[model samples]
Target: MSNGKTKTDIPFRLDRLPWSRWHVLVVVALGITWILDGLEVTIVGVISDVLQKPLRWHCRHLRQVSWVLLLNRGSRGSYRFLLPHRQVREEEALHDHLGTYIVGTVLSAFSFNFASIAVFRIITGLGIGGEYSAINSAIDELIPARVRGWVDLAINGSWWVGTMVGSALSLYLLNPAFFPIDLGWRLSFAVGASLGLAVLLIRRYLPESPRWLLVHGREEEAKEVVSEIENKVSHQTGKELEEPNKTLEINPIGSVGFGTVFHSVFGRYPKRAVLGLWLMAGQAFLYNAIFFTYALLLSKFYGVPVDQTGLYIFPFAIGNFVGPLLIGKLFDTFGRKPMIAFTYIFSGVLLAITGYLFMIGVLSAITQTLAWVVIFFFASAGASSAYLTVSEVFPLEIRAMAIALFYAVGTAIGGVAAPSIFGALIGSGSPVNVFYGYLVGAILMAAAGVVEIAFGVKAERKSLEEVAAPLSEVIENPY
Candidate 1:
């Protein structure tokens, strides 16, 4: 990017200075992706029971049956008549009464836990991975630096919006008293999937990122999109769109696509990329360890009922909802390192205290709930901002792959393994040890923050291209 160019110049053409409807639509699309990203994480708990149950059919058999059903529905002619004939009877349906139930039950864990999540999580993670980077990049490209902070705030805030939606669906839609036990969780999944489809439909009206087009040397296309935007904004506001007087230049090196992330472009800024990855890993690990695994931990160790545990999750989600944007504001305003470091150190301390209180049985139910609310709030705030920091740390070229690699790996190691770690630690004792693990997690979280602060230079003031400079350059001035 040229020295005088504002953040907005990177994504829009000179003829279209003000934003257009296409710009808003793209932001909405990106926002939808973010919602879906968060929803997947939240919905797993709601459906856990359904997935854990045994299915009295082999994996191959199940796949074959599903395939057959799908094929039968697609054919227009004899398929309809044959479909009823091909349907499995209640007696023929796989059930647990036979000795196969025990074997099938054992097999279900591998299928659902290992196979299903392992496969689907990668798909989900890929979609999620694209979402975090794409939304930020699109916003960075489209919105000007002056109000860019607010646009980023709105985009970042969508994560919490997603959390609320997922939690509400889990709490209200999946409540068994209102719906049957077996069907409620399915309904929860259906609600999330429905929202995803709605987003896809809305996104059809959105245009491609002008900045991306510019970077790829498609100047005319970029200019056209920008004109469309300016015209729309002018019509809406009934005012002339004023253009800033500054020449813009795209970085020849930064314009490359996803392949460049792992190659020379990202290879230069290895340490910043690594630090971002570490932060992402730490965030996912600590968060999932707590949020994803909490209900089970409470039920198993504290003897809390599942219904009560689900109810308690509402406050946790609320805390998560509140944490990020406020922290993000401070991040950009005060600088990334200090805010992140403070968040981790304090968050760690809170986790330890929360764990200690739970272990010692020193608090009443309300007090315990309050403590959880605080702990999760801080964690949510810290974790969400961590993504913002990562977004700022890397360059446009490698941003997507870098974020994806860090989160996918982090969630797998820290998040997926959290519950088992808690279970192993608790064994049969007082559940307080779960908090001890959190204390350990806090230390790790703080360590990442401290490392980032000590090693991470201030990138808040720099353009996206400059911050992702080579490791040798970054090392020269780490403050």
Candidate 2:
């Protein structure tokens, strides 16, 4: 309730709690951001066929919806650490969920041309970009550090769950028996938007990070939130909870400016910065290179109908989601460096082999998709881990901004050009040409793996404080 400095063990208290329904609630409520993001993109990918036509089954839209991905980097870092993070997240979610729910990209479906839809697409992109900092920060602070790596990977991996839903929904909606082609694509957006609104409702009951509250000198509020969590956990688990083992004396300060954060991230923690950049950019390129144009490859090279492409996404989405679940535990168990480096290099090597097979004209569409399933089984885990790395390696003071910068920079460096380049490769109808793109992606990923070997932070099972002291603690410890 006061702005005076407060000393509290909020971080220890949060990190020491046993697994309970409270954690599950935290995951479901905040984690939906990734799911909705995946759903929207997959829906676009699934319905690209229908979106090309609007009035009277005639067509007009972007060459592809890949531009949305590029623009998602737009609104990041705009709202970093200004207000309370949870409050900022709720506000962003309100704007994003409401905007989509009201008109959906159904407006895009009704567009007169590409320019019209691009406007709406840009709005959606900015809104989604606005959500990541808040979501990742909240999830990192709330979840127990012992399981942080896996939980983060699982939440990020849930994006594929959205892909599954989109693929299935598109199959049903895009069917001739169910709806007209134009109408079907619009419905996909509407459905995703509705889901967004539903999750927003759930997010309402979620509490602010007690760690955050304590640092802001809202000690009473922090204590109440932590106590309520303990009560729920104890009641639900039928066990008494042990006291937190340590305390943090947080001298609440006004704010850490963007300049101080930038210097700290790039200057004080430059090696960690390199690790984050490579990890993020590598996965960004690999995912964007493959995902943005897989449908075109199916249609142009494999003779699959555009409408049936969702069937291919089925197995692809399955492998992507499953990889994180099965491999995610190893991130915490085996440690972040080895697991991260292994996934990146292994997937990269696998992708290289697969690309060579693809270039030789030996595999069918089904077989190619199967290859992706294998490659991404490892790649998905790696990609999801990339976000976790950035969120955890930085000081909590700059965690939100650091994540925002890495995502934006990484996507720009790797994600932006891969799509257009790959689209042109697919346009050439040359398997060897497309494989060149795959080769580049493979090299990028493998190189990132090498970077991990050299520079990755060993953050597994460490409290956020130990990983990188908060800026307040930095002023106290020059070491």
Q: TM-score for each prediction? A: 0.75, 0.92
What's model 1's lDDT at 463? 53
Q: Evaluate residue 225 in candidate 2 and report its C-alpha lDDT on the 0 to 100 scale.
A: 90
Q: After superposition, how far is residue 116 of candidate 1 from its true place, in Å?
A: 4.6
Best by lDDT: 2
- What's the distance in Å from true for residue 230, model 2? 0.9
Model 2, 285-314: lDDT tens digits are 999889867777787798887678889998
Query: How big is the positional error of residue 170 in model 1, measured in Å on the Cα after superposition?
Result: 2.9
Relative to the true structure, how large is the alpha-carbon lDDT of every model? 0.53, 0.78
List clashing residue pairs in candidate 2. Answer: 52-59, 53-59
Q: What is the Cα-based TM-score of model 2?
A: 0.92
Model 2 misplaced regions, further than 4 Å: 1-5, 53-69, 72-110, 475-479
Of candidate 1, the 10-residue stretch with the lowest lDDT total is 72-81
